[model samples]
Structures are given as C-alpha cells and as structure tokens.
Target chain A: MVTFALHGVGVSGGIAIGRAQLVSHATLEVAHYVVPASRVDHEIARLELAIDEVQKELTELHGTMTRSGDLPGEFGAFLDVHWMILNDPTLSEAPKRIITEQRCNAEWALTQQMNVLIDQFEQIEDSYLRERKADVVQVVERVLKRLMGKPGSLPTSVAEERTILVAHDLSPADVIQFKQHHFAAFLTDVGGVTSHTAIVARSLAVPAVVATHNARQMIHDGEMLIVDGTNHVVIVNPDRSVLSEYRLKQSELDLERQKLKRLRGKPAETIDGHRVELHANIELPGDLAQVLESGANGVGLFRSEFLFLNRAGLPTEDEQFEAYRAVAAGLAGKPVTIRTFDLGADKQKAELDGLARVAPNPALGLRAVRFCLAEPKLFLTQLRAILRASHYGKVRLLIPMLASVAEIDATLAMIDQAKESLRERGEPFDEGIEVGGMIEVPAAVLAIGGFLAKLDFLSIGTNDLIQYTLAVDRSDEAVSHLYDPLHPAIIKLIALAIAGANRAKVPIAVCGEMAGEMTLTRVLLGLGLRNFSMHPAQVPTVKQRVLTSDVSAIRPVVERMKRTDSPAKLAALLDKLNA
Target chain B: MQIREIRLRNAKGLHARVAARVVKVAGRFRSRVVITVGERRANARSIMAVLMLAAAMGATVRLETEGPDEQAAIEAMVAVLAAAGDRA
Candidate 1:
C-alpha cells in the first residue's frame, strides 16, 4: 500500500499519527435537465423549499455555536447573509429562467447562478470577506443538488477512521463536526495567524497549519504526515523513526494541553500577590464562549467590525443591538468595553467598496477615526446599538484611532446623537456608561491632556500605534522585525499616555497584542497600566508576570526605558529589571 | 426605543448558555433589538446572531430596541443581561 502525506490546517495544538481520511469539499452540482415554462412556478417552489431546508439546517448548526458562545453574533450575521444569498433575486430567478430558456435541470440552472455569486464574493477587498466565497460555493453546491431532486448531502464529509482532517480553512462548525469523528489533527491551506480557524484550533487543542498554500494539492487522501503547529510545518512521508518520534511528541503535547486545561478557571496570580487584569480580544460574539472557558476577567477589546465586513450592505441598528445585547448579557455584570468599528483602509465591506484611500504610506494614512467621521451615518448606527446595549450591564464605549481632541469630540457627538435619538424616540438607557479611547497614535499621546480631559479612560493599542509609529506592519515579512513596541518612542508614547491617565486619576488599560505578551507585561505595569486585554491563551502568562511584579518595582524599569535612546537599549534596560 | 450600556460581570462572558438566556430575554420585545460592541452589530433576539460578537465578561456593549413593546423589551433584556452569570 502506498501512503502519502497531506498538508492541512493544524487547528488543534497537539499532533497524532493516524491513517488518512480525506473528505474532499464536495462538488454537489447536478447535471440533469428538462424544464418547461409551465413548470417554472413548480420549479421556483422547489427552489424555495430547498433554500428553506438549507436555512433550517444552518439555523440549527448556528444554534450549536450560539449555545457554546463560540462566535454567536458575527456567525449569526453570516447565516443572515446566507439567508440573504439564498434569497438573492439572481440566485433564485436565474435558475428558473435557465430552466425555462435552456430547458436545463434545476441543478444545472443553479450551478450557473452559483458561479455568478462566487464571482461577486471573490471581488471583495477584505480578505475575510473574500474568503467567504468558498462558503457560498459550498452552500450553492449543496442547494443545487436538492433542487435537482437528489438526496441531500453534506458539503464535505469526514472519514470514518482516525484521520488528519485537511481543508483550505475550516469554520468553527467544521471543527465541531470533525470532533464527532476521529481526527488526528487539522491541516488547512488557508487562514491568517489571526483568522477564526486558528483561534478555534488553539481552543480545540488541535495541531493545525494554516497558509499552507498547496496543502490540498500536496497531500493525498491517505498519507504518512506530521503537523508541527507551533512551528507551522507539515512533513510528508516520514521514515519510521521520524514517525515514532512525532508520535511521542504528540503524546507529550497531549500532556501539556491537559496542563493548560487544568489552569482553566484558576486565578492567574504569581508567587507574590500582585494581581493583573486578563482580558480577551473578541471578534465574534460566539468567541465569548472560549473567553468564559479561559476564565478571563472580561473582554478587553471587542471587535465589532466583523459583523459588517462580509455582508453585502450595512447592517441595521436592530442587527447591531441583537449582537451587543447577547454579549453584554453573556458577561452578566462584568464590564465589556466595545471598540467602535476600526476598519482601516484595506477592509472595504461594500459601503466603502472601491473607495480607495491609499496614502504614500497606508500605515499612516486616514484610517480609524478618520474613516468614521467620513461616514457619520454608519458610525451612528453602531453607537446607537452600543448605547442601547449599555442598559443591560456595565458597558463601556471605546473609540479607536483618536489622534486629537477633535476626533474624540466628533465621536462623542455621534454618541450624543444616538442618545438623543433614544430620548426623542422615548428609549430607556444607562446613564453611567463610561466612554474611552484607544491611545495608539503618537498624536494622542502628545495630546493626552486634551484626550483625557474629555474621555473617561484610555487603552493603549500598542500594535497599531507601534505599527504606525514605526511604519511597519507586523504581517509584512520585510519590515516585521522593525515593528517593535519597545522602541524608545513607542515606549515613551505608552508611558506618556499612562502617566497622563494616572495623574488625571483616570484608569488606563492596554489591549494590543503586545499587552498580552509576558515580556511586555512588566513594562506596561511599570508604566502604571493596571487594566489589560489580550487573547485568552495569554492570560495566564500575563497574570503570572504581573504577580511576580510588585507594581511599585516597575517604576525603575519605566525610568530606565525613558533614559534609553534606542528600542534595543530600552529592551535591554527593561530585561535587566525582569532579571 | 430603549438603550443602555451594560458591563459583562460573569467571569465566563457570553458562551452558548448565555446566548440562550439573551435570546430568551430579547425575544420578549416585539421591537427589533440590536446590540453593538464597537462598530460590530448583531440581532439580539437570535442566539446564533448574538454569539458572533465574542464579547467577554467585564466588557461593555450597547443594547437598544425599537418597537411597540420597546420599554418592556429593554427592561427584560437588561435584566437578563444583568443576570447572565448570576443564577439562570
């Protein structure tokens, strides 16, 4: 028997050696034909029935995620889009017309319509939005078959044996389905470091490799393969010794994962009693499930842009409210700070479609608050929803990309208008909701007095602020190494923001990717930041770091960082403090 | 219409169980209800819709509803939100 290695996404953390079971994403289009004009109404009814059936299945599957809180809000939105896509005039009518015009079968007609929708989805600018093309294709392929009077089938099937699951990118639902079967690990050809697939894999403790451009092509149905997720590598056809070595490593990984699970729900305090805040950055409302599982203090950063990104048009206010309310309610009485839409120049979700705002350097261009002001109505819809959600619990409003007092004023004005709409419309609301701004831009740091004067709190968005300051995208391989938050200027900016907030007696927090890092926790704590928001996976380490630190002891490092001229020097000075 | 800023107090913020609770409370309002975190928005009445925001405990989000039963819907939804991790 010939064995081959298949490269796929490593969704879970650990590795395993098992037989391969390839479940190819299906091509469900039916080639059958025969349509008469008199039967168009019958065909339409059949099509609607098929769409409803798919929607029902989707709705039920959607419920599982909602219950798990895996990604309720945005996932719900995607379903809504599916509902919309299923209901699309072109998608529905094209098939009937083709049946009438070409006398083709429902399956054949639908296959053509699917192509049209795929073309539209592929044209979207946002990578996340573009990736949705596959979802549409899969759904259409399934729906078209049903219209053609074929037995219903899954878009993709799992192998019956313990196999390494492979795909371009699997959704959280896919991961759950995979769990029902025996899978050694997950391997996928698609997804970014921050994509949902990776996040789910990390939570599932599945070993996954993403961005494996040729995974589907490189791997066969059954193969001897090894997936090293941490290193982002996939090896095919290993010798017997290498396979045995990885098998042992896989067992070891399982033990480590068990250790991580044990840390769940435990307070992440160090030997010393210093406590730190551990928060997660959430994209969809469903991801809150993992947040709760991780026992984080609360959400540090709530990314709402995902709701609007993949859809065809702007979501209504009611749509916004439903998403916010579930999350606010989910957290019970804990504080949830929702950052307003932070879609930069690159993410165009229809309204901003084809509206290029390219600067000589997009990293330093008109984005965040600038984009919000340029689209006030869109901004107002989100603010109104958040304002309404504030009634449910302790909800804080956060604004991103505020470089000046002016942007803050403008954003606040929108909130006020939202509040007025509620008032004029006789709506009840919370008066105590706190308003905050992310201090990432140097301009915000320089104008701290102005920002803190009006804003209630500040969260240092070190990632973007540093990227903008250093003119480097951490994702850019060429300049990623230069994207250091430890740079003297970056550190100084953070320090200035923290010092200003502390002096003003206003609370300060950091919610960037850096805030979750162990190396940076001390530096931030030393800078007088008590509030933090990061990924759930990082909470323990950050908390451990915080506990080891005496809040009082951090001042010395802050002092040293200020004295250092270069980022390397600053990092060295701070490293000595941790030492 | 009813509007409010609510903090997630439950240590385990908005998982599936909480989404059910949210849907139950939000469904009482005849008004179209929407909740927002930052710029992201979703329908509060549906569990699948609500879980997408991925909001964690102690985070802040906004909830608002407009309909014939807006006030009652708001109060009930807020109450459910406040009671998320408390008991049921």
Candidate 2:
C-alpha cells in the first residue's frame, strides 16, 4: 500500500487515528435502466412508495429534533423545507411522469428530474438562494436511498467511536444525524470554515479536515487513516515508523487531555494565590451540559444572534425569553451575561431590510449597537426578553460595538423603555441587572473613562479589537497575516482598558479567542486580567495554564513587552514571560 | 379567471422558504393558481415551479386563478406576495 497525504482546511484542532469509513454517495451511484411498458406503472408505484417513506422519516426526525431540542432553529427549518419539497408535486409528481414517459427505473427518473431542478437553481443570481440547490439534492438523495433499499445510515457493524467518516459532502441534516454516533473525526471533500459541517465539527470538539477535494474517492474503506487536524493533513496507510511516531504524539495528547480534566475541580488560582475566574462562551442553551461538565464559573458571553441566524423570520420575544431563561436558570444562580444580537457584518439575516444592502466595508459600517439604535423596535424586543429571563437567575445584558458615548446613552435609554413597557404589562424582572459594554472598537478604548463611569462591567473582545486596531479583515485570507493579536498597539489598548476598569473598581473580563489561547494566557494575567471567558472545551486547558503561573512575577516582563515596538523583541519578551 | 399583478415586497423575494410558503397558500384553495414573472410562468402549487421563476424583490408578478374559489385565491396570493419583511 502506498503512503500518501491529503491537505485541506482544518476547522477543528485534534488528532485521530482510525480506519476510514467511507460514506456512500447515493446521488452519484444512480443506475439508469429502462422499464418495460407493462412495468411502467410498477416503477411509478415504487417511486411513490419511496417518497412516502422519506416523508415519514423526515417527520419522525423533525419530531425527535423538537423533542430533544439538540439542534438549532436553522436545522429544524431546513427539515421543514425538505419535507415541503418532498411533498411538492414538482418533486413527488414530476419523477412519476418521467418514469411513465421514459419507461425508466425509479432512481433514473428521479435523477433526471433532480438534474433539471439543479440546472434551474444554477441560473439563480442570488448566492444564498442558489445554495438551496444543496437542500434539494439532499432531499432527493433520501428518497433515492429508500428506493434502492439502502437505509442511508452509518454501518452499525463497525465501532463507530474509532471510525473516521470520509464523505464528498455532508448536509446539515447528515451532520446532525452523525452527531449522535460520536464518530472519532470527519473529513469531507468540500466545505469552508463557516460551512454547517465545519461549525458542527468545531462544536463536537473533534478533528475535522474539510475541502480535501478527493479523500473520498482515493481512500478505500477500512484503510488506516491518521487525521492531523491541527496541521490540516491526513496520512493514509502510513509506514511502520511513521505510524509509531504518530502513535506517540496521539498518546501524548490524550495524556495531556486527561491531566487537564483533573484541573476542572480545582480553583483557577495562580501560585501566589491570585484567583482568576474562567467562564464559558456559549451560543445555545443546549451547550449548558458541556459548560457545567467543564466546571466554568458561569456563562460569560451568551450570543443571542444564534436565535436569529439562518431563519426566514426574526424570533419572537417569547422564543427569545425561553432561550435566555433556559441558559440563566440552568446555571443554578451563577451569572450569565447575554450579549444583545450582534447581527450585521457577516452575520446578517435575510429578514432585515436595512441590512440587505451590500455595505462597501461591513466592518466599519452600521453594525451591533448602531443597527440596534437604528431599529429600536427590534432592539427593544430583545431587551425585554433578556430582562424577563433575568427574573429566573443571574442575567446581565452586554452591548456590543459601542464606540460613542451617545450610542451608549441611546442604548441605555432603550433598555429603560423596555423595562417601562414590561412593568406596564405587569411582568416581573430583575430591577438592578448589570449592563456591560464590549470594548472592541479603538474609539471605545480611547474613551474608556465614559464607559467605566456609566457601565456596570466591561469585556474586551480581542478578536474585533485586534481587527480594528490593525485594519485587517481576519476572514480575508490575503491580508490575514497582518491581523496580529501580539501587536504592541493591541497590547497597549488592552492594557489601557484593564487598567481603566481596575481603577474604577468595575468588573472586567476578556471574552474572545485570546482568552482560551494558552500562549497568551500568562501575558493577559500579568497585565492584571483576572477574568476570562472562552469556549467550554477550552476552559480546562486554559485553567491548566492559569494554575501554574505566578502573576506578580510576570508583571514586569509583561510591562517590558508592552513598551517594545519591534516584533522580534516583543516575541522574545513574550517567550520570557511564559518562561 | 381572475388575474392580479403585485410586486414582491419581501427582502429576499421568492427564496426557497418563501416559495414553499406560496405553494402552501396556493394549495389551500380550490383554485388553480399560476404566477407569471416576465416571460416565465409557474404553477403556484408546485415548489419547484415557483422557485424556477426566480422572482427578486420588487419584481412584478401576475397571479391568475380560475376555480370555485378564484376570488379567495387571488386575495390570498396577493397577500402572500405583498408581505413585507416576511415575518413568517
């Protein structure tokens, strides 16, 4: 066997050594066979039966999704659209007509009709709508699998936990079904970092390499596969020495993971007895279980935008309230700071008309607090819901992208109005809930005195802060290398915010990718950062870093790091601080 | 037969979910609903046909209905098309 490698985008970070379990692409394997005149009706009946079975299957899956509430709203809406397409005469009826006219097998007829619809979808100019072709393909594949007597499920004979799933592409529905199996890793031939497959893979905390281009076609079933997700490489049929080398690396990772688990129950305190608070940033209430298991002090940033994304309509206040209340109450009296819907700029929904226009520069355009102020009705609805949820547990409201004191005053006024409306309606809420501002914009950091005086707390969003400070779009690959978190200016801005908040005696935390990053953990602690919020899976590892550090000793090293403008000196200073 | 013209008022025009909603509304009446956008015509009860029309926001579409409930069908189809910001 030849040992080779495949490289792609690594959306999640980990290592997995398992046998490749190929996911059969039913759409590509369709066979065309002509039916006799006498059997045309039989072929049509077969297609109908398959459609019926698929409809039932979709209905049951939807019910299970609703009952468990494990998946997001977008997944449920996708299922509903699939169900509608399955029942539409355009899908269920067109293929039967083709079967009669062409005297072909059920699968062949369905494939022909699917091709016609995909051609029409290809002509669509709107990218978002054109992407609906994938949904149609997924729906048709389900029915085809039924007609072929294939159940469209993972092979149960294998030990699924030790299996690496290799597929050409995976729809959101397929990813949801695979989530229950707890596969070791996922490798697909096509998907970007923001693809549904990648998002699910990250949440699963598994090693996944997407856009492999040909991993599904080249690798045979039951082949030895080593998925190095951190390096975005997959090794197939590795030689003996290479296998042993990877085995050692794999065990080292496992042992380190086990060691981190032991730190979960221990306090995230430094060697000098300075206590640090570690919180988890969650997007959905379903993540509460993992948050608790990781022993996070509380929920740091509950992004309210997930409720609004990928749906046709905005979520009603009651729906928002239910989600917020679930997370707040689930924390068992621990604080959960829910950020207002940070929609717009790569997170825009189709329902908002004002955001429909293509902004020349979305990063600098109307977003976050600006959009909220522009559309006060929508903003107030979310505010009222968050307030209502605060009655259940410790809930705080955090506003995003506040660059001006006037915007802050406008947002505070809107919150007051929401409270007034709720009081008029005779609803109960927390009278003195904390309101915080996210210091992502450089202007906000420069005007730190206003924020420290007005807001109850503060959170430094290092991702946006770095992007704005460096004038780099992190998503744009061409200039992404310029987006440096270790830049001296970023350090100065963050240090200034921390110092201002500490001087004012206001609580502050870093709730961004920087918080979980182990390399920068000591740097932040040395700069007097006592609170950190990151992904739940990252809590244990960062906690491990916090336990071994001496904050008092690293402060001077970090101070020297803060003054150096040279990249080389800064890098060396960071090394010394960590050393 | 009754024909009425209305422009799509939703931000996304006739996207998949919106097209599906149109098909569902058209199915509720005993009328045959056919919508025409530019030169392309589609059976409103068929999701694929409705989607193939590719009607964008502000695109003028003509709705035709002929059956026992033609009047009700025209009214319902017009309402669905004219719905702004589609809070479905």
Best by lDDT: 2
Cα deviation in Å at residue B84, candidate 1? 34
Docking class of 1: incorrect
DockQ of each: 0.02, 0.36
Give lDDT tens digits, candidate 2, residues B62-87: 99999999999999988888763445
The parts of candidate 1 lying over 4 Å away from their true place are A1-20, A28-140, A143-162, A169-185, A191-207, A240-272, A347-361, A550-558, A566-579, B1-88
* Model 2 lDDT per residue over A473-559, tens place: 988999999999999999999999998899999999999899999999999998899999999989998998898999889888999
Instruction: Give the local distance difference test score of model 1.
Output: 0.70
**What clash count goes with each model?**
109, 0
Cα RMSD to the true fold for all candidates: 12.0, 3.3
**Residue lDDT tens for model 1, B1-88:** 7798899765445644455567666766679989887677878864434555556556687989898998888888778878764531
TM-score of 1: 0.70
